[model samples]
Target: MNATTDLLRVDAVKKSYGPIQVLHGVSMSVARGEVFAIIGPNGAGKTTMFKVMTGEVASNGGTIHFDGRDVTRMPAYERVRQGFGRTFQVARVFRDFTVLDNVIVAVEARRRHTGEAVGSWRNCAPSADIRDEAMSLLADVKLDALADGAARFLSHGDKKRLEFVIALAGRPSILMLDEPTAGMSPSDRSDIAKLVSRTRKERGITVVMTEHDMDVVFGLADRIMVMNYGEVVSTGTVDEVRNDPKVREVYLGKEMVSA
Candidate 1:
């Protein structure tokens, strides 16, 4: 792929927690509109790497660039302004808020970040336009029916869908998902996977994700990056990474990948 087509670039990113190093010279590039997956063992530093990429945590060293600009030191909010949308491993919706309100908040935040004069936010009710837009997002995730329902009352799969809707409200250029299908039944996992694939296709957004389910990973990812012990073991097309000797030794075994 052409270098210019790359939307996200991580170069030698390093992170540490106290004396324990978590990410060691990690580097990868995500092309625009590609579904990229990062996989490894439990302590492989995938989440830590995500934190550094999204500005949730500061890196001890190295640089991160997005859309042709350096964002290594950018704060989380500012990164959101630059079109980074993220959903956590655990769905982090506003439990007390209604499903509609949860998305309303996200749309409002996006407006604020972009300096779109949305009127006084103090005691402000969601405008008709925002409500329509928010509902549209929810509908995309098939959660519009639950618009007035409390988020806390939704099933775990529905909550994850709500979170995805919230992220979509930001109109992100790239979407990052951490274990999007975690802690769900196989059916729910399949639902989330389909939602992700459909959303990416419809929006033309780049996706960076980590998933433990190899079936979901192989089914959705255009490319895969394998990590081990805070380092990148391999990065390539799914077939290439799946066949990599190093990746086989450290992460996926022959049986695992073949199955």
Candidate 2:
């Protein structure tokens, strides 16, 4: 892909927690409107990488560029405003609020900046546009019927789906998800997978996700990046990464290699 077309670029990025290093000289780029998957075994620093990208966890070294601007030191909220959005491994929701309300809050945050009231839900002003957009986002995630329900009452899978909708509320150019299928049953996992694919297809949003499920990674990724010991071991189309000996030795292991 052309460097000019890349939406996000991470150059020799490194991160540490006190004396321990978590990411070592990791570098990669994600093009606009592409589905990019980062896969690894447990403790490969996938979540830490996402946090670094979002500026939730400060990196010890390296540069992060988003939409051609350097954002390595930008605050998390600032990153969100710049069209980068992410979902956690664990669903984060406003438990007491209705699903619609949760998304409305995010939409309001995305647009309101500071010192501005989100205003009454029934307000007829243009600010009410957030509510309309939030409701539309809920419908996109197949949660239109649950719009009035308390987020705490949603099923685990539905809550994850709701979180996806909330992420969309920001109108993000790039959506990063960490273990989106975690804790989901097989059927629910399939449902979320379909929802993700639909989001990419219908909205043309770029997707970057990390997953432990090989089937999910292989089935959904347009391209894959494999990381080990905080460094990217290899990255390529699914088949190329699958055939890489270094990836096999570090991640797939000998038994799978033999198979």
Clashes of 1: 0
| Highest lDDT scorer | 1
Clashing pairs in 2: none
Q: What TM-score should be assigned to candidate 1?
A: 0.96
Which pairs clash in the backbone of model 1? none
lDDT of 1 by residue, 152-227 (tens): 9999999999988888899999999999999999999999999899989999999999999999999999999999
TM-score for model 2?
0.91
Q: How accurate is candidate 1 locally (lDDT)?
A: 0.93
Summed over model 2, clashes come to 0
Candidate 2 least-lDDT 10 residues: 121-130
TM-score of each: 0.96, 0.91
Encode model 2's per-residue lDDT on 60-139: one tens digit a residue: 99999998899999999899988987898899999999988899888888767644567776865436566678888888
